[model samples]
Target chain A: MNVAANEKEVKIDTAYPYRTLSYFVEDPPTGNRVDRFLEAFAVVLQYTDYKSLLDSYCTTNNKCNRCAVSCPVYQVTGNPRDIPCYRTNLLLEVYKRYFSIGGWFKSRLSSGIELTEELIDEMAEVFYRCTACRKCSMECPMGVDHGLVTRLGRYILSLIGISSKALKVSVREQLEGETHNTSKVPKVALLNTLDFLSEELNDMFGVKLDFPVDKSNREYVFFCAVSDYLMEPDTLMGNAIVLYAAGDWDKWTIGTQNYDGINYGLFYSDWHLERIIQQLVQEVTRLKGRNILIGECGHASRSAHDFVPMFGGKEAYPVVSFIEYTLNCLQNGKIKLNPDIVTERVTYHDPCNMARSGWIVEQPRTILKSFVRDFVDMEPKGRANYCCGGGGGLVSIDEIHDFRMEIAGKIKAEQIAATGAEIVIAPCANCKKQLKELVEYYDLPCKVMGLHDLILTAIEIPNGKSAVERKEEAEMFAM
Target chain B: MDAWIEFAKGPLFAVSFLIMILGLGRHLFLQLDGLVRRKGRRLLKAPWRKIFTDSLSWVIPVRHIVDVHRTVLFSVSSYIFHIGVIVVPLFLADHIILWERLLGFHLPKIGTLLADVLTVITIACLLTLLGCRLFVERQRGVSRVSDYVLLVAVLIPFLSGFLASQPQLNPISWRAMFLIHLLSAELLFVLIPFTKLAHIVLFFFDRISQVHWQLRPGAGDMVSETLYGKEAKV
Candidate 1:
């Protein structure tokens, strides 16, 4: 584990173009001892053990570039180092130097290369550059899960305190703060936001809508991204209106503490992901809810619906997307939409978590079609859709906003422009944020809206009062 | 010359075959061992079913090749080269004769003309692939010395065999051409298990692992409970 002691003899291979020192800036030592970092790397490798697949990926004759060709980031950047396989190799090279059979032989032949701090910095930079969208995994011939590799790389980097400040702060807030939300919206603030949303909905639709909080024994424990409380109240109002119209008003309630479904842990650290999901499961179980209905956030829904069970074991309740719930309501004739209300040319952006992981691709489209007069599909819609460049917590990192806009977000901007749609329906919260930024930065003639936003505009909410009462009120008004 | 040919066809061939078998067996065994060790409390419901379907899907070029625009040409050329290499070597009269002589079993053979045409096509495809690796900017960035060496190793046998089969087109004496062909083929057999060529057998292992890892049941619920303690009651 004396990795740093042997660092003096480490020879940087200048022959390799990417190994140049110019691409990286050396940071002062931050108490991350080389021995401890090596231990963490070994532990992660043993936990995942992707050696055979990685070996084949690097050595196979085809050197399959399917992941690279399909990767939206790489497609936009055109940097060979950004290729998913190449990025994975950065970790593989470390594994080969210290732990592999070849490394054992090579160590005997020469003082082998040490995993340097600079190399770790480069790994951190490249791994974070990726969105962890898993679109690359879908196309890889060997099924080398690049998403897993990226997350693991980030996890290892996190051990040495090499993660983004933005993501770290969010996780800290959720775990340590009393509010238990990433945005740190307090309980009273959340209730006030809900009350404001109810007022807004009544003003617009002439119907009373209430957002139930902390009620027990509901059929579903609804969770939305915490940012919705302040940034997107319309979306929250849309959720309430749809739920009330669908006759599920009494069937669902939002938890007071664990209402926010945004899980930034899925972006970097496995430790954080597990803790967040456990808290989510505990909230649902405590409420005596029969099901967990995750609202219109891609990674949140994915974390809750897909990874929660994996981390928490089988839950008493089933986890579902609010999109699926709406689709069911539409199918059952409990709710109806007036298509003329949304006459603009609309297109859908498939959040990678929903389309690729959750298989919630068609459900959003179904909901959109039910309300929109003109619905267009992106050229490569569904699972193959390009990332909004803000996934993997990149949207939260303000320092890299330009990097996202000029590079990672480029392909998505182009994809949206190609469709020539005026309205882009991003069902996931993360996608909406990225898409909105892309529209602003690229100056595209399109506006970003949430699926629930569209639903609020077109949904037909029935007046709860009886017809006789309404007629008597009208007669009284005439008198 | 006769002595060299005799050794090439006898001891050299046997030694190479033995190394290839043991090497491939060890490689596949280690991969399977890794798979078993990594299974850890995770349910692989219908693993065999997943492995079979995934293997079948990957073997066909349609999904992996034709559907992806960037890989269509490379995948098509690879498919053609792989078919020619496997089919020509196994079904040619000369190879079947050797197999029958060694193992006392013979299979039906393709016509000599067809075998020759396929061998030529395979060599051409291999050369094209080599060119792509050398010339394609992105591919060149990832290409290593082993990649070039492996391609040359595969190409020598096919090129020499083609020349040996048609003595009229031979660039040297018949005995020399035949020896070069035999020696190169033997070299490939020895190298297959140690080099990237191991992918031939390891492809199944990689694909199966990928499919099973993706399909691992309860992936949604199997928290790294060790990392996070028991769920706290709200």
Candidate 2:
């Protein structure tokens, strides 16, 4: 169906208003799809054996609404089915009908529904609807990790060849293909983009900056969301300026093999997540870098910092977020910032992966406070901040644009509007893209920028050569 | 009727109490066993100190339910109800006298007026919670048959006990009302392990398992330490 048609069908403030059998239906699989799905489900159960835990919350009359009250999607759509507990209950129903001991008794006692394609389709549709933000789990008195359950559901769906086209194309095909990045920018194009960004930096800042690529034996191997190289040149330039000013130019090099740090696998499929992490580990190892520095993307930073050890095992090197690295540089007085560079009121949006996952919360705030003179905070910022409505790879899929803007993004738009900040410093790439779109769609009269972008504006590069001299040197190098 | 009353107060109560203990014990043991098995596969070193501190924080209603979620009215009412449910049953003069007669144990008892007041508040809170489940759209969406049934199960005992204490308000015979109250209480005890009341024990375990359960420092840092054996740093 067309986007507009889908939007028109979705009625707000109703129970399962978007429920249509068409959205759940998929083409028949080639060979014995039911057996394959059940087999995959069995495999997943092996990995996640929390049947008792599920039972604790799944009991009849256990209407623990802690998760429901906190769920952002349910908060927006007002759909009971969208509640995190309800979603988890759907899985629990599946477990009870198929696997649990009590399920055996239930099947015999009642005319129980069989696990069919329709059930799988509904599960896929609902599971993908969630952002897997874990915000619900945070407030849940039972601590039922619905996020993990949703992820497992996605994994099982993928096994049955039921998955989102956007996730498959961007995360699986593109990353596994020759480009090795989600944006599909080839190596040549990447180098050319860097060169073009370098020229732009020279024209704008009148400083000679270099983005080292493929240089070996560096202290830090910088990996950023490849989209940043194309969409947010200023963010890339900001990263370069900070590294160069910190006198870590020789210590850091962007890997030629895997430049993008984004792991869409975290949002959709575990196989994709594992492959992405393995590729990152291989890239860092190939360069023999001391530390893996993930640039301003929340999920990528989190995946690299947390999942790498699980996937990389003994080969896993230390993974640090670019924000943490920058904060460390500032703390050690490795770089200086001109406080008057930005005078506008600035606020920060905590990416769910960073804030909720507890990866790099304070570092960004510390950096933001250093340069932003008129700094303000979004109410319930830090750990309690609302998602940008484009998390969980939702930003990549154009099909859900209206759903994001109207329902999911509603609370976030209000939060940003209430802040009344001139600029919003969203460090995560996904959040930046979402917030930027939100500003345009909501007409909120605020510009969205990366955290490093603000730092770049405020950073005072150490004086070494005059602007004219640097331009002449650049010209000489071009010759 | 006399034989049934004797059975209800003797063998039936003993049987229900046994079921409650064994059923809840098995449930808790299985849960902890799952944790142990999961730890082996995940290679997780338990952060006992942080777990204990986080569990304690949640145990205090002010820190978790009130301060964290800010559902002031619901949380406040829940606290009062829980206090009444626990305090009145153990310390009421009638229950203390019964315990003395049956088990040869005696404890200090609260004044009948105070017990009466506590029971009234407890019953009121139970009704308010039931109303919330029935009327609140979000709560109603998640509510199941068992939820309403469980609430009714709990309410019967409190209501009957309250009526029996206030003879002026009693609509039934004192002996009949008292017998009904004891039977309902025994039914609740038997159902505790099989129903949502398991949360009374599961709450501590669940709170400790959450990602937010960090007391030493930032939750993220603690997660990093647990996952990677070192703090997340450059």
Candidate 3:
């Protein structure tokens, strides 16, 4: 409402702080008109409203900027806009302007803010810049979860069809595509991958290993970021080897439907988040599995484990992370791991989705310390650890490779370097991808892989021949 | 001046106190309302004991010293300011007498010397915070006009109350300072629920929400059917 006759009229709703977020919107929003931005935000707000929480946060945010110290992106970029508090306020201010009583009164009195195309575009860029790590939430005296607000902002923007292409495309596929997985891996391909992995493990360990699929009435149905089959064969094999070694043959099996644990909706859309979790639940239900076992992916484990009872309703299966299951197995003497295999100095990178809330923090550390002889903790390890910079699904976006490397992932690169470790083990599939990129980009002398990737190397499986024995047998047998 | 001071301390004080109570009560209600999920069963397995103890850590004035070893001087000062501002007004002899008259009960009074020391400490902390908002480049960049205005709004009552208590310390007329102190505090009371000052009540809720992120199972299930598309639920 620029109803001003002269330029001298004070526009109270003038985009004071957020007007500066005039960056490029990666995925274009649906509506062309600027006013449509507000309508979309309103629709999303009503659809997934946390009014009391948003109202308090919007009312109480003092712009302390303390969160900047904890923000990996803000620390490297040194920009006010990158600050978690500022990023969160991008939505909070909108909440105030459009939803709150005081802002309504003030807006009615004066020229209030118009949700502009530029503002929506600004949000499109700002929200993605955050890894949604939730580290900043630790330092906030007001207890505002800046990452949660960023998620809310992203959800609103996605409603207007402005989310990152990487996240949107994958989520769209997972929702509507025949494969029902983010990576679009068909059941046949997944089974083939399992068969290939079984042969590889058999050759490596001189032991017969089977990657069980679609097996019914198992004690646990496993799900990991499905892309693991494409890139993380060792991790998948490690999971199979560990579960097979730790329990009886029928203890765990991978289901065909909803086998992929990567829930991109957790980053940008509540609608997707719920439905994706439902897929995982349906898979477990279909298998008649008693428990859900989420593999090395952080958000996959968290979203599945935390929300299963909610989405599953009367049939809430007990959900466990791979780390927790392995830790339990190790403690119970269910499996043995050789610590001597890892002599190189190693450090654990706490994935934000897993460790930020202390859900899967200690279990991984316990598992790592068990087999990792030279394990060293990062300066701010565990719940306070910095993001791998490619968090919140940014790792999936190849376009922001430079932004991820130099700015967003900068702190993580340095954190890895500071550890001076040869191998940096990140448990989450998302974190593993980001850290590998960070190491390569930053020119650090560290190799990145999953926790299970190393575990597979050191695990002592029954009927598994020693490496030396297997090598000698290969020469003698002349196969 | 005598009549104005009496009016400020008696009826104005009561009305202001009522507004402050009702306003904070309403704010407290809103915050509690936000915590409730209508569509699903609230998970009883949240580590509430741990969450409560962890949240209590935020209230300790110097927890930064123990938590980060950095003592984040800004927060420590803000904490002291918060503690002092609340404690001084409640336990100061004059305020206790007013409370006694108004509510038929009073908190245990602090010695005049101790009260004076706390008031000065609170004022100094306020100044330190003000300086931080003004001088610290990062904080100043984020600071709004309302930030400075609110600091001054809080300062008026404290500065005036200290001056009003001892006539010898008062540069302005003691009666005038007394009236200003009473009026400014009342004004702050009215503004509490609307401004950043709302944090005085909402901070606990904020902490709870933070812990709530690692939610108990299906905490968000209520919105499954009722919230967006009915077909949205699989």
Best by lDDT: 3
Task: Give candidate 1's root-mean-square deviation (CA, Å).
Answer: 7.8
Q: Which regions in candidate 3 have their CA more than 4 angstroms from the true location? A: A1-27, A30-34, A467-479, B37-40, B43-50, B61-71, B211-234
lDDT by residue for model 1 (B118-152), tens:
99999888888888788877778877777888889
Question: lDDT by residue for model 1 over A290-377, one digit each (tens)?
Answer: 8888889999987777566566676735788889999999999998887666778999999988887555888888888877879999
Candidate 2 vs 3: which has more TM-score: 3
Query: In candidate 3, which residue pairs clash?
Result: A13-A112, A13-A113, A310-B218, B39-B222, B40-B222
Q: Poorest 10 consecutive residues of model 3 chain A by lDDT? A: A1-10
Candidates 1 and 2 compared by lDDT, better number:
1
Task: State which candidate, 2 or 3, has the greater DockQ.
Answer: 3
DockQ per model, Cα:
0.32, 0.23, 0.46
**Candidate structures ordered by TM-score, highest first:** 3, 1, 2
Best by DockQ: 3
TM-score of 2: 0.86
Across all candidates, what is each one's fraction of true contacts kept? 0.23, 0.26, 0.46
